[model samples]
Target: MLMQIEALLEHIEFLLIAGIVLVLAILALEHKDLVYAVFFFGIMASFVAGFFLLLEAPFVAGMQIAVYTGGISVLIIFGVLLLPIFHDTTRERFETIRKKRLGIVLSIFVIILSGSLVFLFTWPTEIPAVNVDLAQSLEGLAQWLWGNHGIYVQFIAIIILTSLIGSLAILKLEKAEHLNPESGVYGLATWDDDTSEKAKAGNKSEDTVPVIMAQDAEEEGT
Candidate 1:
């Protein structure tokens, strides 16, 4: 009897976890506000970590929290906050995004893709009794990252970061150049306010002539 009861309880617990994950995934997708969506995404990541914990995978759970919940969530939030598209009021910005048929189609496709992936993945029915020593694995990984292979990995990461920064800088420069009144991209000169003003001033100076009044002439004669 106790075995049957324990099995029932376990099934109920799995159902609850799966339901929570499903609900969060739907909310994250249906959410219109990017900020709210980010929070929902973080919550979803946390729930996934919970699943990893239930599987007796502490390292996976920790990494899910550290990498997805913390790092990726922060990056998403920052993208929505720091990017030009997010600088406006949420209504106008999202309304514009909503109007784009391509965006809508892409979003639907992604939702379908994610749902399909979830269905395709095989969820383990039971947790393993024995687990790998994550501490040793992590220690080995640390040594690999910071020892013999450290130089190449470090340089690769630096190059990637530099490339990202350079791309962002180029994008910003392009936008600024489009907005600039005095010059085009790459310091190319264009007809602008300064040029117009200078031309007008030159034309005025060339056209102007000194006039001598009759009264000035009489005073000079006297």
Candidate 2:
């Protein structure tokens, strides 16, 4: 009875996780706007990272959430927000034929690759003992990261920081250019009250001269 209950719980958990992943993927694909798509993709990546955690791959899961969901997704969202596409008033253009074809091909490739990888790896899987030495595993991972993989981790961090700063700089420049009169992007020429009054006075003087000239012409004709 206990074993059966455990099996049922596992099944339920799997189904719940699968449903979350599927929904997130669908949301990502169905959204027409880039910003919404990035949001859904981030959600999907986070859920996938959670799945990895359930599978006992804590390091891989952490990396997934950090790099794909946190770093890449944030960058994509920032780019989308910084661009003018978010303000578009027209309907979004559908994917081109070339893009559709490429997407289909990629989907097929992913399916095939996933199948092949599963087949290759699952058949030789010696069922290792379930005795997970949590402390030892964590220590080894930390050592590996700080010893050999440290430089790579630092490089990734630097790249993400650079991207963030570059986006901020671009946004700042765009705003400054819009506000600067000399830039002439969005600045409007504001006329002073004195200039307006002078223009109105000049118009009145021209009107009086025209009227006098007309009267003089009429009197000469009579």
Candidate 3:
């Protein structure tokens, strides 16, 4: 009876987590705000980590939380926030509405298809017999990841860095184009208000100095 109760409770917990993850996935895909969408995605990832925990894979769960929820989600949020055009309100509302709707529909369809596939397919029920050493496995995994695939990891990092730089450069060019339609470039040499004011002050001082000198000479002659 106690074992049955524990099994029942686990099923309930699984259902609750599954429901939350599904809702979060829909919200992440359908939300109009990019930041809110990313937040939902992060929460969904956390729940996925919970699923990994339920499967008795604590290492995978921890990595999921650390890599997806902590690192990737934060990077995506920062990238969205740092974008120069993030606050641009002049975009046409109708331009991407169709695309967004299509994406939502496609996502829903895909989810349904995947569910059907999972239900139809016969998954392996038997556990494979293997003598596994946890510490040795982990050590081998670490060595393979860092020693064998270190260059690939570095390449991915470089790609991410280049993408960020390229995004910034593209946004800057767009801003410059908006500022100067004819030249398609922003001129740094253009006089700003401060520069113009300084020039005016210098001219006024030069004129006033001559006038003061003339006034002083007139007084001396008198």
Candidate 4:
């Protein structure tokens, strides 16, 4: 009876944790404040680490907490801190959301993309039993690294570094573009060239109408 009760309690705990994780994920995605969203994500990551720990995967749990919960969270926070816009007290900038209809369409597109990605992930159907020699495995890894794998590893490192630099440049350029949108090929509305030209012509016509009206009034008085 006591064992059954304990089992029930464990299931309850798991359910509660799963609900909390779901709530945190929603909050992270939908939160108005970016900082609050970051906090929610960090907390969610910590809970995931705890979940891994519950499964008796201590090493994976530690990495989740250290790398995802701690390191990445700190990196995001520091990036926000470095940005001057975040420091501004009366910042009008808020996350721009797509129109509801567009979002719904995009959501469907995302679901399709996600399904494709999910199918691409190959899951092992059978676990093969093999005797793994710790020293031999390490030696093999080292030799592979020093040989054919070495070139690939170097290329991977270069790609990672380039991506990092490119991302930073994009962020900086994006911010500048936001500040001086005319300097870029795109605007906030990102109207096409023909649309912009039409709008300019419309504005000029509107201005000329006012001037013509003033001239008519002056001529009538004379």
lDDT per residue (tens digit) for residues 1-222 in model 2: 997997698678878988999998988877777678789999999889877766667888888989898888998889778878634223433234567678789999999999998877847434365744667666778889887689988998999799889989998987886677442323432444454455456544334555655665665566
Worst 10 residues of 2 by lDDT: 86-95
Candidate 1 global lDDT: 0.71
Provide the lowest-lDDT 10-residue window in model 1. 204-213
Model 1 / residue 112 / CA error / Å: 10
- Candidate 4 lDDT tens digits, 40-149: 99999888876765554566677799999888988887776777653423332212334555777998999899999879999775437554455655566567776757
Overall local distance difference test of candidate 4: 0.71
Q: What lDDT would each prediction earn against the true structure?
A: 0.71, 0.73, 0.75, 0.71
Pitting candidate 2 against candidate 4, the one with the higher lDDT is 2
lDDT (C-alpha) at residue 117 in model 4: 86
Summarize candidate 3's per-residue lDDT along 115-174 as a digit string, tens digits. 999899999864466544566656776788798899988999999999999999999987
Off by over 4 Å in 1: 1-9, 83-222
Using Cα atoms with residue i matched to residue i, what is each candidate's TM-score against the true structure? 0.50, 0.56, 0.56, 0.47
Higher-ranked by TM-score: 3 or 4: 3
Candidate 4's TM-score: 0.47
> Which model is ahead, 2 or 3, in terms of lDDT?
3
In model 3, how large is the Cα lDDT of residue 156? 91
Worst 10 residues of 3 by lDDT: 86-95
Tens-digit lDDT track of model 1 for 1-222: 998997798778778888998998888877778678788889989888877766656777898999998899988888888866533224322323335777879989998999999899997766565655778656765777787687888798899899899999999987776677343222322445565456445543222222223444454456
